[model samples]
Target: MRVIEVEHFEAWRAAARELLRDGVPAGDVDFCSPSTQKSLFGDESDDGGRALAAREAAARQRRGGVTVPPDFLKRARMVACHRDEHRWNLLYRVLWRLTTAEPNLLHVAFDDDVRRFDLMAKSVGRDAHKAQAFVRFRRIETEDGEQFVAWHRPDHRILRLVGPFFSRRFKSMRWTILTPDESASWDGAALTYGPGAPASAAPSADDLDEMWRSYYRSIFNPARIKLAMMRREMPVRYWAALPETQIIPEILAEAPARVAAMLKYGASGTRAVSAAEFLPEARDLESLARAAAGCRGCELCERATQTVFGRGPSTARLVLVGEQPGDQEDRHGEPFIGPAGEVLNHALVTAGLARDEVYLTNAVKHFHWEPRGKQRLHKKPPSRAISACRPWLEAEMTAVAPRVLVCLGVTAAQAVLGRDTRALKTRGVPFASEWCERTIITWHPAASLRARTDEERRRIARELAEHLRVAACA
Candidate 1:
C-alpha cells in the first residue's frame, strides 16, 4: 500500500508497471497518498493527507485484493509521478490535472499535492505553454568561444523528436539544449544532448535576427487581434522568444504606430525615392499603375491583396472611371478585367468605340474587400479614402487630357464629380464638375452583374455604352 512519486507521467507509469510485474496485488496499493512536507515547497500542512488516507481505506474495503483496471491504472500511474518537493511539481502534477476526471478522485489526489497542481494552472493549454517554456537559449561568451546555447527542463523527453527542427533552423551556429533529464547540441560536428548537465549557455545572434524581428513586427495584423486566440496560440511564456514581444505593449497602447511600422518594414522603405524622382519619363497610365503598386498613400492599401492599376490606351480621348478594384481586380492586379470589364467591353464596341479608344481606369487604385473564407467580397471604400486617391486619378487625367469623363459608379462619381450621386438617378445625363469638363454618372458594370438577370445587365450596359459614345464626342 505504498505511494510512489516520480517527476513525469511516463516515469510514474513505468514504476507502476514495474510494481505490477513484481506481483503486487492492486488492492494492496494506494495511489492517493499524502505528500510529506519538504523544505523545497516550504510549509506543507498536510492539508490533503487525511482525505487521501480515507479514500485509500474505502477503496480497499470495496474491492479487497481486486486487480486494478489496466486502463485506469495506466492513467493513475501517469498522475502519481513527481520530480521534487518544489513549490510546484512541474511534471506529474500537470499530468494529474490533465488526467483527473471525477471530483471525488481529484479531491483525494489533490490532498497529496495541491500546491504542485496549482502551479500548473493556466487558461492556455499545456502544450502551448511547453512550447514557450522549452524554446530556450541565450548567447554567452565563455572561454570556449561564442557558442549558441539553450537550457530548460521539459516535462517530457520530446527533445529527441523536436530537437532536430531547431538544429536545422540554426544550423550554421553551435548550440546546446540542456534539460533536467538530458541535453542535446549541434556544434557543427554532431548532435550531443542527453542527461548530464542541468545548465547550458546562450546562443549568439545572427546578422538576420534584426531583419527577422522587423519583418515579424510588420506582418503582425492589428485588425485580427483576438486576445483569446492570441493568448491561446502564444502563451505568456513564449513572449521571451519573440523579439517583437517588446512592441506588444506598444501595440496595445498605440496600435496605429505598430501597424505603420509593420507596413514600412514590409515595404523596406529604405529604398523609397521621392515622388518627383520616381515618376516615369513617359508618365503613361500603365507606368503610373506600376508605381502605385508601391503606394502606401492610405490605410486601405494595407489590407488590399495588391495594388490594382487601371489599364487601357494611354492616348485615348475618353476616360472611364470606376470604383476601387473589386475582388478579381485585387487578385489579378489589373483594373477593369473583371466581370464588369467584360460587360463594359461589349458595350464599348457596340457604341462604336474601339477597346483602345478609351483610357480605362478606377477612381481608387487598391482593392477594398472583406474576406469571407477564400473569397474577398468587395467593401466600398470610405469617402475619405476615395478623396485621398483623387490626386492620382487627377494626375492620370491631367497627363492624358481626355475629352470626356465617364463615372462608372457612385464611388467614381464622388471622386470625379465631387458629389455623391446614385447611378440609377443620374444615368444617361451629362454633368459639369470642376475636375473634368463633362462627366456622365452611370451604373458600374459590377452592379449590373450583381442584379442577377441578363436582360437587366444588358440594359445597364447599353446605357453605359451610350453615355460613353456621347462623352467620346464631347
Candidate 2:
C-alpha cells in the first residue's frame, strides 16, 4: 500500500486528487495525517510520492478530470477536521464511489461510509461550537495597546472555521486565542494563524475577572439550578481556561442554602425572567440587536415573524418610541418602514427632523397581530407584553441617552411613563423623566389612519406633525 501523508483538508485534497488520477483504489492507499502520525507500518520513500505524481500527470494527459457533487466537497472539509484515524479513508471511499460508481452515494443515508463520515463531520461541528462558546478571553496589558488572550482545547481541528466567528465578534479589540493544535490572532483588520500553544501561554486572571464573577453570581438563579443539564451543554472538559467556570462549583454548592433563604424570605419558588435576562453583557448596539433576535421574553415573540429592532445614529439627540411593529415592519425586521411609517416619515420632514438622524424604536419589538382571512390585522399589545418588553426599550433608551424622548402614542407613553398614562391628555407637553431629560407624548400616525372621518384624520395627522415639531426643536 502507498503511504499518503496529509496535514490538512487542502493537503488531503491534493493527495486524494493525485491518487484518483492514477486509478489507485481507495482500499489500496494508506491515508495518513498529523493526527494519525504513529502508524502500524513504516513511512514510504520520497520516490513513492514522486512516482504517484508522475503517474497522475501522465493519466491527466490521457483522460479528463472526474467530478463529484458540491455537497461532498463541503462535508469532506469538515470531516478532515475530525480526529478519527479512518476519516481520510472514509472520505476517499465516498469520493471514489461518487466519481466511479454511484454518483448519488451521499443520498443513501444507510450506506456505511456515508453515515460514518456524516457522524465525524457532526462531531467537528459541535467542537467548533464549543470553541466559540467556551473560549473566554482574558485582558493582557501591553505597552502597545489593549489586548486579550484566551485558551481552549477543541476536540477537532476547527480553528479555520471558527476564526472568522471570533474576528467578526471582537474585531475592534486585539486578541489571540491559543489551542493545543493551533493559534489565531486578530488585529482589527485581518486574522492570522500560527503554531499551537499550551494552556499556560494564556493569562490566568485580569482586572475584569472579579467583576465578571460578581455579575455571574448576581445573575445566578438558585431556583433554576440544573447541574446535570448545564454540565451536558457546557461539558466539564471545557472548564479549564474559562474563568467563569471557576466560580460555578461554589455557586452550585450554595444553591440549596440560597433557595432555602429565598423561600423563607417570601421570594417566589420560580425566578422571574425578562428581556433583561436575555440581554448580552456587551453594551454595544449591534450586540444588543443580535441578542434581541433570539429574545423569548414574552408570548408575543412566538407569534411574531421576527424582532423588529430599532435603527438610527447612536449619537441622536431625539428618540421616537412607538407601540409595536406592524405587519410590514415585522416581515422586514426594522423599526418603521410600513404605510404608517410613510406618514411618520412625511411628518418628520415637515417637522425638520431627518429619519436617519434620530433613533426609531418601539415599546414592543414584535408585531402583535391576528389572522383575518389572508391578512394579519394589527392588535394592541397587552399590558403584560408591554411590561415584559420594557427592558429592551429601557436598554435602547440607556444606550442612546437622548436629550428628548417622544412617545408616539399611549402605549409608548405608558411604556416610558406609567401604565395609566394617557397620550392625548398629555400630548405636545414635555416632562422630566428618569430615562430622558424631557419626555413628550403624542398621537401615533396609526391613530390618525384609523380615524372615522377624513376631516378628523387630517386634524389628528396635523396635530401629530405639530407635536413632532416641538420634539425636533426641543
Best by lDDT: 2
The ten-residue window of minimal lDDT in model 1 covers 119-128
Over 1-474, each residue of candidate 2 has an lDDT whose tens digit, in order, gives 998777667667777877787788888998876544332122446674576557557655755668888878888889988978778888888888888879888899998998898899889978887787678889988998889999989898798778987886676789999888788899999998777789999998888778657645654567777678678767989876666788997998999998788666555534334788789898677778877887767768657767888987789999999999999887556777777898898899989887878899999998899999979999999888888888888889889899999999887888889977776777899888887778899888898889999999998889888989998878
At residue 139, candidate 2 shows an lDDT of 90
Q: How would you encode candidate 1's per-residue C-alpha lDDT over 330-401 as one tens digit per residue?
A: 654567766777888887877788765577788887788887996778888887677667767877887778
Which lDDT value does model 1 have at 259?
61
What TM-score does candidate 1 reach?
Answer: 0.42
What TM-score would every model get versus the actual structure? 0.42, 0.57
- Global lDDT of each candidate: 0.60, 0.82
Give the per-residue Cα lDDT of candidate 1 at 73: 44
